[model samples]
Target: MRMRTKAVLLIVFLSCLAGCGSREPSAQSPQAASSSHADSGEIVLEADSLKLGQIRTAPVVVQAAPWDEFETPGRVELDPNRVSHVLMPVPGRIRQVLVRLGDAVQEGQPLLIIESPEVSAAVAAYRQAQAELRRAQSALSKAERDLSRIRDLFANRAAAQRDVWAAENEVAQAQAAVEQAKAEQEQARHRLELLGISPNEPVQQISVPAPTSGKVLEIAVAAGEFRTDTSTSLMTIADLSHVWITANVPENLIRLVQIGENVEVELAAYPGEVLRGTVRRIADTLDAETRTVKVQTELPNPSGRLRPGMFGRIRHSHGLKPVAAVPPAALVQDNEGAFVYLEKGRGRFQRRRVRAGQPRNGWAPITEGLSPGERVVVDGAILLSGK
Candidate 1:
């Protein structure tokens, strides 16, 4: 029994040794270790491996193009120049509102009717002034006739010379009165014209016309509501044929934006639809509270798809600048973002994330991450990327 136990123990020991030998880690092999590290993105290669992979690196260069870029939040807004506010023309009850909110209107189109006493008063005053003018003219005619008869009598020696002089003075006084009456009549006529009423037809109602052609954006007063405040706006109308997309750019970044420059806008409501516009306006003063400058881009919106207060983003790029640039082979894109293999000396390559812009003319401007004069793996970068 003892001899059998010793032979069994030897067999067990040999079997344990064989299992340990089979479980040896692949790290023992240099090639296997390098392959494993290559899959991890960062590369550390030996002299032979570097030469075998045929890695070629090029120095980052300066490219004069749209090298600097940034995106900011934006919004759709109404153009202030095209916006019109309707105020109460006269103090009266609003008898009728001809248009509703969102309704299109034309210039000089009547928008409301008001039963105002001002119009009637103007017409009455005009008529009274006319009658007074007529009476003065009749009196002047009688005086002139008397003066002429007195002059003839004096010439024939049938009347005193003082009588002719006195008659002439009376005629002069009558003429002056007629002139004063004519001035009064003119004043009354002007008042009627201002009230938009005719002396021939006296009416208490006055129609208010639109000052400008546009779409009615708001209505503050309703029909039958008496308004005495003519200074307060009763409604708002704006020309929606063109709209302004505004974005508040930081005070530091305002230098990149200017009037008449083109910009690309994207709205959240319409994804994947890019709208292009020109910068038509920029605030002269900066906001003290927000420290931002309001910039507006005008876009032709004949279809009226863009509405005010719609949120979006504004992308602006300034003139060409000297920025770090690399070739397309140097850039590697994955789920995270675009990156490049930066070549450090001594067969060492480091992976770095880059803010690369659109590729242009075999060069991708690197807005961030890489710098000019730095070396990056351009050719055979795929070998270092390890898939």
Candidate 2:
């Protein structure tokens, strides 16, 4: 009876154990199974036992591109058209310099006086021409009166025809002398003009005058400075109503820079200030040494605040168009090339190649290899790339 009772108890315990196992999974095991299922769709696993393969992913929208415009160091330049160098035309000693450095001058205003033999000779020639003109006029008048009297006498038969003809000839000679005197006067006037002396004035010395209305930028000549035809410089003047900012752009971006394109310029001397400009010229050839093309832009300096030789930075857009752009942080470069990853799903990404374009205000242009409105892994690309 004791053995049968013990065998019944053992069978009951076995039955209970089987029933429990068939009813449900344990709490911990079900939780782990659910987690695995959740990770299945876009699973990035580092399990040593699991193997995975690469897959084609949806296209990614990149905010960064390789199409950024190239930049080169540049400086402000004096506009060639607005600059004039005041130099003495003939060899002379600078008797006096009338203007100082930075003095504003008007066109044709005399800045200095130079005493030279050439100027004195021009003045003397002009005076001699004037005296000769007076003498020729007196002679011509006397000859005309004599010819008129002889013609009257011939008409009345009191003078011979040959005598009257001879008087007419003398009158013609005097008239010719008058014309010659007038010609000489004009020649002398031009000579004085070349020496910077006015024809109507008695200027004993040559005057160095300003060619244009502008401020004197440099003064190399002082009182009593000896100047010659080959003198390096006397003074340099510049019209600062406008200036030029020349920038060198890479050869690849030369096409983007066109005349009339707007640009923003910033000077190092004037921080936090931006000047406006427009493209004026684009170089036809690239510089061999730098492999860049020069572009010139004009900036208005109505206030005369901008100066030459100032360092400047230029900014402009290539105009907006459809381009592939991804966040700047999303771009990854390596030995292979530039690439970005697209997020097909949670924790999933696929690498892709792209060509970039110009970047403005932190947004870059994608020249190719991307479309608009595609989701890309920007913040977590590095982490997702591991998967």
Best by lDDT: 1
Worst lDDT 10-window in candidate 1: 63-72
Model 1 alpha-carbon drift over 4 Å, by segment: 1-41, 44-64, 67-71, 133-187, 190-195, 260-262, 271-276, 320-349, 353-364, 368-387
lDDT of 2 at 64: 36
Report the lDDT of model 2 for residue 151: 91
| Residue lDDT tens for model 2, 12-102 | 9999999888766675687986787566545343434223222323344444332334555568998888898876777888898888888
lDDT at residue 107 of model 1 (Cα atoms):
90
What TM-score would every model get versus the actual structure?
A: 0.63, 0.67
* Candidate 2 Cα misplacement greater than 4 A, ranges: 1-74, 98-104, 108-110, 117-120, 187-207, 230-232, 248-294, 312-319, 327-338, 349-351, 377-387
- Candidate 1, residue 199: Cα displacement in angstroms equals 2.3
Query: What is candidate 1's lDDT per residue for 1-387, written digit by digit as tens?
Result: 999999999999999998888766543677786777777655677777745368889999998866345578999999899998888767899999999988989998888889888778788888889999999999999999999999899999999999998999999999999999999999999887766678899789988888898899999988999999989998898998899988999988888877998988889999877889999989999999999999989989998888999999888776678788999889999999999988887688889999888766788888899988899998877787663
Clashing pairs in 1: none
